[model samples]
Target: MVWGRKKKRGGRKEPVFGGVAASLAELRLNPLDRITVADDKPASRAAPRKAAGPGGDGSRERKPSQNRKGRKGRARKRTRGRLSRLFYWGAVLALWGGIAIVGVVVYVGAHLPPIQSLEIPKRPPTIKIVGADGSVLATRGEMAGSNVSLKDLPPYLPKAFIAIEDRRFYSHYGVDPIGILRAAVTNVLHMGVSQGGSTLTQQLAKNLFLTQERTLERKLQEVELALWLERKHTKAQILELYLNRVYFGSGAYGVEAAAQKYFGKPAKDVTLAEAAMLAGLVKSPSRLAPNRNPEGAEARAKVVLAAMADAHFITEQQARAATTRPSYAVKPVGAGTINYVADWVGEVLDDLVGQVDQNIVVETTIDPKLQSVAEAALIDELAAKSVKFNVSQGALVAMTPDGAIRAMVGGRNYGDSQFNRAVMAKRQPGSAFKPFVYLTAIEAGLTPETIRQDAPLDIKGWRPENYGHEYFGAVTLTQALAMSLNTVAVRLGLEVGPVNVVRTAHRLGITSKLEPNASIALGTSEVSPLELVGAYAPFANGGYAANPHIVDRIRTVDGNKLLYARAQAAPGRVIDPRSVAMMNTMMEQTLISGTARKAGIPGWTAAGKTGTSQDFRDAWFVGYTAKLVTGVWLGNDDNSPTRKATGGGLPVEVWTRFMRTAHEGMQPEPIPGTQRGGPLPDIAQLGRQVIAPAPAAPASVGGPPQPVRANVRPEAASGLDGWLVDRLFGGR
Candidate 1:
């Protein structure tokens, strides 16, 4: 219409170019433009196109070709819509999966301890047992050897563990992906879980923080902690921690302790063969220990050596040579007896320092040389006679006059029984307890010269008899004690009132309970060898109270703080000097002419008591010199009687054996209250030499008993018996 100048009729038609009042909208750039010339506005909605049919009826109609095209177009649109729906759901699933993954990560992280608070727990603190001269006797608590740094170990040692435990330990992160994959493949092929994929770091994480639980969650946590360890510590540090804290077996922990326990050497000194053996122990510590299963241990070590060779840590030739070398558990010297001392120290540890939170060093009073000597004496003597005597166990303890334990042999073989007989087993002292009774009597106005009947006597149906069942009609107090006449001891206990005897025993350091009765004088009451020896200490140390003690001082490993120390208080005087002199003078006769004659020391003045418990169930000898006190006991642990084994037999023999060696380097100190105290005279030099017999004396003797001394001048004696003792016996 515009082309036709629809307009010719448009009344004046808006002038050709729309002059004065015309709008710019009337302009059209092209024929397809919808701008109108008359109204100058955009057109309204278009009406549907209609096909003309049969004389302008304005009805719509379709052609066959158009219908076919429309059908194909609808099919194409349907296909495009299907593809869009597929893509939209796929994206939704992917987003949900991502969210799930984030949730799992957050959930696992929540189970962990705070990262800032993460810490490797301190291992059970090791208590080092040191001898008096500063040599390590043993470590009491956790390890035999002290802690050692990785740098101190031989390079091959750590490499051996690495070769067998984790081949790629140094190359990978804590959780090894390649190792895990290999293990997975292996497990799949076997159709079961046959191998573990834990790296050394992972194992450390499990040991330090996690329970030994097998679960999906725990494994994930382990992996996370391992990764943290890898980030926080160097590879070497992680390896060191793993090595030092891992258990090897046989009551040992740490490589250093393992080395000392199994090889009797330090980790730094272990050979290649030993290193391989130790490394193999990690796989099956209890089952593959060299001590328990040497064959298994050696076979595993061979595998480890082969692995080392394959890893280039060692040559094939070297590995083969190592296989030829023997690497087995070595038993430490005195393992049996020395452990008794260690156990005693362990019991005292808590008392000394509340709780052992850190490593500590305990300086004990044990003398290594003396300890060895004492053990040998007890063990060897028992070995020679136990079968013949029908005895199964024995114990011995040696101490200074001040009650410092120098040596302790708790049993014949600690491996067979860890029972500490020396400090724990309580048995009748028998006649050995008569000394306390006699000491009490001497304090109650009796003397070595005071006479008492040794005949059988009865007190409330309790009849006491002598060793041979033969009683002397009348014997001096010294004679009765030296002879260990049971009747005389009972009579004295009753005369002095058994309560006083009990008091004397307790005051002298007998910790065991005592029955204040007639039988108490015969040592019917039970007492430990430790207390017996400790009680005897007063007699040896000039009547001072001596409480038995083994520990000298306890301090931290670094020796900075003192946790416990033996107080240096002056000893309490438990007995007056007169009573001590009489007691010493009387008991010394037992070593010279009484029950313990065989237990004599050649160069020193010695005194002791021999005891044979009821039915010979227990035999004991508690002996002392001026400086040392030692006690020995032998019996069956079940309290069975022996084959007539008396205290004077095996116990005396063992005591003599130990005392002879103990006195070799010691200066001879005379018995107390002796004016001419010095080196004892050699008895062999005076064999059968005739001396004037002692003159029979008064029925009732008076005055202080003669002092037992060496090299006494005959004229210096106040009586004939004293002079004869000086000349013939050289002062007991």
Candidate 2:
């Protein structure tokens, strides 16, 4: 507070503040320092203070030792220019990057389907074809067993998928940057693309809503959809959707289907090994399918097991045990011939229930027992005789007398060829077609006792010959049919008019087109084995026409809704009762003493006709009991000639094998019109052959309508036919 200067004469004594300013100016210090102190002076510029200022007090305002000019020489004035450094630009760049990210998100979001309207597509319907026994024979449709709930599946099954496909499946926000980085680094380390970054949720998005395109647009959409899914659905729900929608190999579309297809079990019953195997299939379904490549599937399964162990989903021992003995896919029981049935059912599903828009069950009429027998019969017989007889293919169709199909084997090996020979192939029936001609003749007032000469004769340019070109001069009508005498058949066809024979065939069941010519009796018309077998059904049912039918009733899978059912309306009578009886008698002789003796059903009454096509191109024997009518054909796909293989030979043998087992445990029903115990009353009226002392002469019989008589026993009379077959044809 002490004054530094005396007052001037004209001015009041200097104010204290003014003196302080003057003192500062005199000291060459800043005038502003009077109120605001300046920065501390540099130690090098401070002058040493006089010792305690003569009073030993140390507190003193030190003076500058260096001049202000000297201080100015050591420092520079501030300059103005750009203020930004690297850190400043870094902050600005970060803001722009955030905007770019937002813009990209919006662009991807724009392409997404409306979240409000987004919905899972409807699962395609599966058609399950069931056998007559109501057992599942095969499944036909887009998915084998598509819809399976996660709760229904074994815990290990889904865990196996989670371990191998998405390790952080529970934690990620759909798009896993950590996973992406890890995959990138792994790929870089391997110097190739080795790891995949897609989560299970991403895969499900691709399958459900996107085409399998690798374009950036699709990928971005997939990412956006995955994120949306994560937000909208619980982790478990998303996982379940993925499991139910993901593809498996071999036309299987989901874990349920894959489980049934490969392991022959439901997803819920899947073992640890099976779960691992199925999970491995998600990576490359086609390549890792067990059926296609068991080794690759097993190796991939081991990888899945290891992953499961690493994820702590399964114990190390369990994983090790699964890898030790790798799981194998089961060969489905409903393979081979069963698949043929499945295909046949598939072809008829539309007609039965209209378009197959929903899951349905087709209850077929196939007898599983007979089906196995028929397949085995055809395959075993062909395996033994196909090369020798030059017959490369064979088919069999068996049905109840009411026309419910019992068994159908379309080919020797269904895997080799899918062409359904039983229902699709049309081949000449040869003498197997004589029933129509005989039936027509019987309808025209001729009896089974009517005599017809077996002597060969030419009709126009066609001269039908018997198997050995030999003739039995005076054989009865029954004898002619039993012997399969082509000349007699032709003579009868001309006598009744081939057009009439064709009409008779059509009335019975044959749907194939027939040419009305003399050779029609010789079976020049091409007919599928199905048509031939169906036409023979009238005789087995005693006069009713039962068109061959495989589908008995069709309905929805739940069995609550009925789609179709065969009508209870009566089957129309195809053949006259008297004529039917007459035809049965004549055909029965064919089994007893005809070319088809080898095809006779042991301990049961059965009748069928055997035919050998010209050049032995086709051999057929269509036989029937009161219970069943079966037709078998042996030939080549190219219609190549067989090596003298006649209907009386391999065809007869095959028929015998199948019928023997088919008729097991069945009662021996007498052939209709034949003696059950006592001779049929009015044997003449019933059309039973009136075997008397000798063959009746035309004068005694008054042409042909009057019943004729013969002395020969049926057993003795049948010997001639069997002898001729064995001698002329290579018959068993």
Candidate with top TM-score is 2
Best by lDDT: 1
Q: Give the TM-score of candidate 1.
A: 0.72
Instruction: For candidate 1, write residues 15-132 as lDDT tens digits.
Output: 3664643343334233333454533122223322454334553345557687668667766877899999999999999999999988877788799998779998888888889999
Pairs with steric clashes in candidate 1: 7-10
Candidate 2: what lDDT?
0.79
Candidate 2 structure quality by residue, lDDT tens digits, 1-732: 867887678875544655764565455533333454445576365544433222443234435554556566545321111234556788899999999989988888788878778887877788888888888887788665757777788889999999999999988989888999999999999999899899888998899899988988899899988988888899989999988888888778888888888887888888899999999999999888888788888899999999999999999999988888766766632337877788898898788778878888888998888999999898899999889989999999999888899999989887678999999999999988999999999989988878776554545545556665555555678777877777677778877887899999999888989999868988899999998999998898879988788898888877889999988789999887788778877778777666776667777777888888878899999888888888889999999899988888887888889988999998888655554333222212212222223332332111222232334233333233445346533421
lDDT of 2 at 406: 90
Residue pair clashes in candidate 2: 692-710
Each candidate's number of clashing pairs is: 1, 1
CA lDDT scores, all candidates in order: 0.81, 0.79
Q: Which stretches of candidate 1 lie over 4 Å from their true place?
A: 1-113, 122-124, 144-159, 167-198, 210-224, 227-236, 250-253, 256-271, 286-296, 309-316, 326-336, 557-563, 674-732
Residue 550, candidate 2: C-alpha displacement in angstroms: 1.8
Which segments of candidate 2 are over 4 A away from where they belong? 1-115, 142-156, 167-199, 209-231, 250-253, 260-269, 291-293, 309-318, 327-334, 676-725, 728-732
